[model samples]
Target chain A: MNSRLKFLLLNLFLLCSLSAMAQEKINIGEKQAISSAILNEKREIWIHLPKTYNDSSISPAKYPVIYLLDGEINFEYYTGMSDFLARPPYADMPECIVVGIKNTERTRDLTPTKSQKKSPVNPNVILFGDSGESENFVRFIQEELKPFISKNYRTQDYSILVGHSFGGLFAVNVLLTHPEYFNAYVANDPSLWWDNKVLISKTKSYLEKNKTFPAHKFLYVSQANNEEQNKNWNSEMTQAIEEFKGIVEKNGSLNYKHHFFESEVHGTVSYPGNYDALKFIFKGFRTDIKKLSKNPQLLEEEYKRFSEKAGSNFTPSETYLNVVLKFMKSNDFKESEDYFINLKNSLYPKIK
Target chain B: MNSRLKFLLLNLFLLCSLSAMAQEKINIGEKQAISSAILNEKREIWIHLPKTYNDSSISPAKYPVIYLLDGEINFEYYTGMSDFLARPPYADMPECIVVGIKNTERTRDLTPTKSQKKSPVNPNVILFGDSGESENFVRFIQEELKPFISKNYRTQDYSILVGHSFGGLFAVNVLLTHPEYFNAYVANDPSLWWDNKVLISKTKSYLEKNKTFPAHKFLYVSQANNEEQNKNWNSEMTQAIEEFKGIVEKNGSLNYKHHFFESEVHGTVSYPGNYDALKFIFKGFRTDIKKLSKNPQLLEEEYKRFSEKAGSNFTPSETYLNVVLKFMKSNDFKESEDYFINLKNSLYPKIK
Candidate 1:
């Protein structure tokens, strides 16, 4: 065939080869509505686990949990982030179970106190309808939800509470009122403007009294650019946030972090904010294999430091050690060889 | 009750309230194996779609797709990022269908050419067993997978090819060999050092000929800090990447972007790399309601620019329109009233 004819024929073949069809559904996490005696309602929740969650051969261990409020809306995003961070390469976050609590009453459950100001959108209607149920909501999680999780899920003592907007307010409320419940709290763009900044003022007094915590706590607060949208209105909001930050900063017991994202609006802040929150909480999570391989002494120190922060003791799991070993063996590092030998001996002291 | 007794009683009540149960499984996306004629084998695939993918009620439209290489390992991470980016609050990314191509032969499929060097980790073992099959693999995707996906899924013309490490190398190869395949290509820490940087040298020649593309393609290249471990080894990788960047920079046909993640090593680059890639490709994705409300004209111009770039003559979809209208109605923007009417009129045309 001629070159032009050959080109035309190839194009015809390509077009004939490819055609379109119907699409299949991509399923995500499972949802369940567990009856909550405390809230006197059936609370819906979405649960997502790591691939190795049930693989006994891969990971035979308990994992930490991240309990996200507004499960129906926010569960996928948070759980997805956790699932991503937990895996190889990044390994910035450990594999864990995610429990997303779907809201029964958005205003009622998430809000700490009833608002005197009318709804921002509606003039006559209260901002929070049948509100200030957060105390009960926290109780439900503490008494009903948590116990159920412990029994059902492979949960460790370490727990994280993640919330946004009204949910963020609830998270902070839990942190102040019942700090013992979770090891870490992530509050993104919290509605501190609720009831004329009462929550912010309340935080200072709470901080004064609560100087000691049963366990160390990581509190991440992310501020959105609400000021740009509603400048005069958001003055109160900004003030409340600043005051809360000041109080938290002064409070030595709390491992507090505040990030102000001018570029990200109220809604958009959650993605990067939540990501940073997790990264902050799990600081030093990604093992420095190059550093460790160079100086074996650093591994123990690194692990020790991570244990103190991660809540879980820093002993490398068998699977984790194997991954490290593979990398080390690939390069042939002497210090790591000795380190792995010691680890193997300690784990299998019964042998030989 | 006495203060001490009251505290004790409260603690006891809290402790008694919560208890444990049997763990439930966390449901994620399903997996399947499709027979490929090109490879003469059934290739495993994992598919995850956006929430609105099936729910026509909320979003009566098709979505763009992300075709991920090394699907079994990287699917969760990529899908997770997309899921996070798609939803409210962080609606930074549009809803996307994720089609993860699970590897039957990682080295064989990913590498375009055979390596002279043996496996760095296992010297006796060849680096790539039955390698140099990327051309066949691409054909499998073009003739088999693409057609299968088109037949099965509600996919838009806007497709993204996401790959990491050796998979990343495959992505760029596809871009060079068949630029008609995808709208965007994300190559994260591409193993450009493959077969002594022959791929990098090949790119210049391909760029020299391919001055025009079927669709304006977005090509995002990310570099990991390989220098953190082996300076000399990383030097070659960096050189190949730099050469590719230099060539692409000179070539105007490719919408090029390069990001160097100093902190993230070879393995961890995929997380932030993929995230940034999506963000870069979908530049100005988040419709600035604040800007739109002020000057409704900007919305048209903004979307027009995007439409031109995205290969979709992107009229704001009905679902996107509704989201904007809801926010506008909530705030009661006067300028937005006309915009809403225009949108509603254009979409419904028959509404009373």
Candidate 2:
């Protein structure tokens, strides 16, 4: 072949290869850093907005927020999970913004009481020496992090705090120390045994003072299978959780759920625990689409009931209304379709 | 102010604002499209590599791949879940490459038979008009898609097929027809009643012919709470699943598990179902780090047993080995630490 023709063929091959290799990224969220005065350090957070949050066709919507501890470990699955659960038509819960807090001092920030112990594996070494500054950490979350999020994102009043292990201890500490901070709390196999079960005593004192958990509050605690851990180093972990479960169940005032995961170890419990917590926290959020197709008015009634229980007002999302409209339109339910269109317009007025 | 000074101030303000708003995306995967000869159409696929896939410190690793149906709906969460479950120290399964296939013609590609029925919502309207070309679809996957993946990625021989609803039906159909295609199959709330339970008959005939499933193959089926569905138009779905479950259990030859998710509905079952399916498929894959500290040889023994059952030669991943070495070194298990170092060096030899 001539030199010019050879060069032309090479260029063509390169062009085809480049086109074939062109790829699009699947981005779930973004990383943002904030300087926290309370903690006296810069904290990085990962924020994930729900799928409909940026849809141009729909009116902008506010979402309930979840403050996830152990951001680096849990953020990806947690965001994916919340989105899956919040899909329209069969949404188990409302769309949510997940702010995953990355750790600067994991032991110090998550432990409730300053304590030190010999390492389980090496008795000569000390562990958790710099532990127990959760008060300052919670302060940072409340005074700095929450404001940063609210100022930046379209967030609803309703929020949830979720954590595992020491992070779970931080969640319970926050609920005990500042009950009004979050609408719901999830602690997955928490280190209730920390400082000899300090949180259990705090829970008792709070119940004695308040007589019942502040109205409309919810707490979901998941206990991992301790049969193995009991044989290992964390014997007190399961016992403490069981003791706490009895006290809360006896009080029967807090909207409380305690699930014992028989098959999961402490390391694995948070995954399934988070799923169950969402289901429990938003027990009445799922509205039947088939029923809605028949009785259009039932949508408002269900929302009203759910709002009353959630202690927060929540209207149907514009995306959900659109889904309902499509379902009704495809089914030839003209009246129901019209009903949902009106509902959508009333809730999310088009700016133009 | 002087004009030059004013311009400098404006430029400084712009730089500050831009830096403050700078964001990094959390990307899980990438999208790629390929033209399929068997199906005679272009198909898009989302590919998610494990977190360690591109780590410069580690050698390139070949990984088991999961072919997830309904890429648009399930890719995000499925990728996140796999990564979470594959974390070191308590890794439940091996890190895997996830290839999610996006659908073009849903009914036509997923259904096993060309059949049409009246729309459940609108009796006058027909549904699934151009139904049934799953044979062609499977051929596309086997002949075109699999080769495309194999050529471009570092892939282990083992693979899994996962689906829900119509996609789930497609997975089961493939298992019966092309049992050797994948190592495992997961079907969440599968539409077994599709085309009048055609797959159930196919399963019966396959069992009759083979007398037993191929060795080392696994299947997991999850049934959702069909109470609401039973009251609706999908009354037959639950019965059909139950019938399939009975027939499979009676055969007692396939490595199988059937779970009933009492809380999950059809639309929401896949989230939890996928988690359970992974645990079931890789039941003995988790090695105890605590135990390994004392008995370093136990790691190889466990992997051997697991591999024997899996019919795939499994070994400890470099990441898992690193985690183990760290655990041992920190805990002062000097001998065990040395043992793991040698194991890692032998398994992942550095190119010097």
DockQ of each: 0.16, 0.41
Off by over 4 Å in 2: A1-23, B1-23, B231-233
**Highest lDDT against the true fold, candidate:** 2
lDDT of 1 by residue, B35-109 (tens): 987899999788886776766454357778889887866776577668767764236767888899988888888
- Tell me the lDDT of model 1 at B62: 73
Deviation in Å, model 1, residue B124 alpha carbon: 6.0
**On residues A1-352, what C-alpha lDDT tens digit does candidate 2 reach at each position?**
5565556556555644543443377889999999998888999999999999899988888999999999999999999999999998889999999999999889999998999887766689888999989889999999899999999999999999999999888888888889899999999999998987899999999888987788889999999986566564568898888898899899998899999998988998999999999999999998988788889999999999999999999998888888889889888888999898888889988876
For every candidate, how close is chain A to the native chain A in TM-score?
A: 0.85, 0.93
The positional error of residue A131 in candidate 2, measured at the CA in angstroms, is: 1.8
CA shift of B304, model 1, Å: 2.1
Chain B only: TM-score of model 1: 0.85
Query: Which whole-number lDDT from 0 to 100 does residue A145 have in model 2?
Result: 95
Per-residue lDDT of candidate 1, residues A261-280 (tens digit): 87677777777788889889
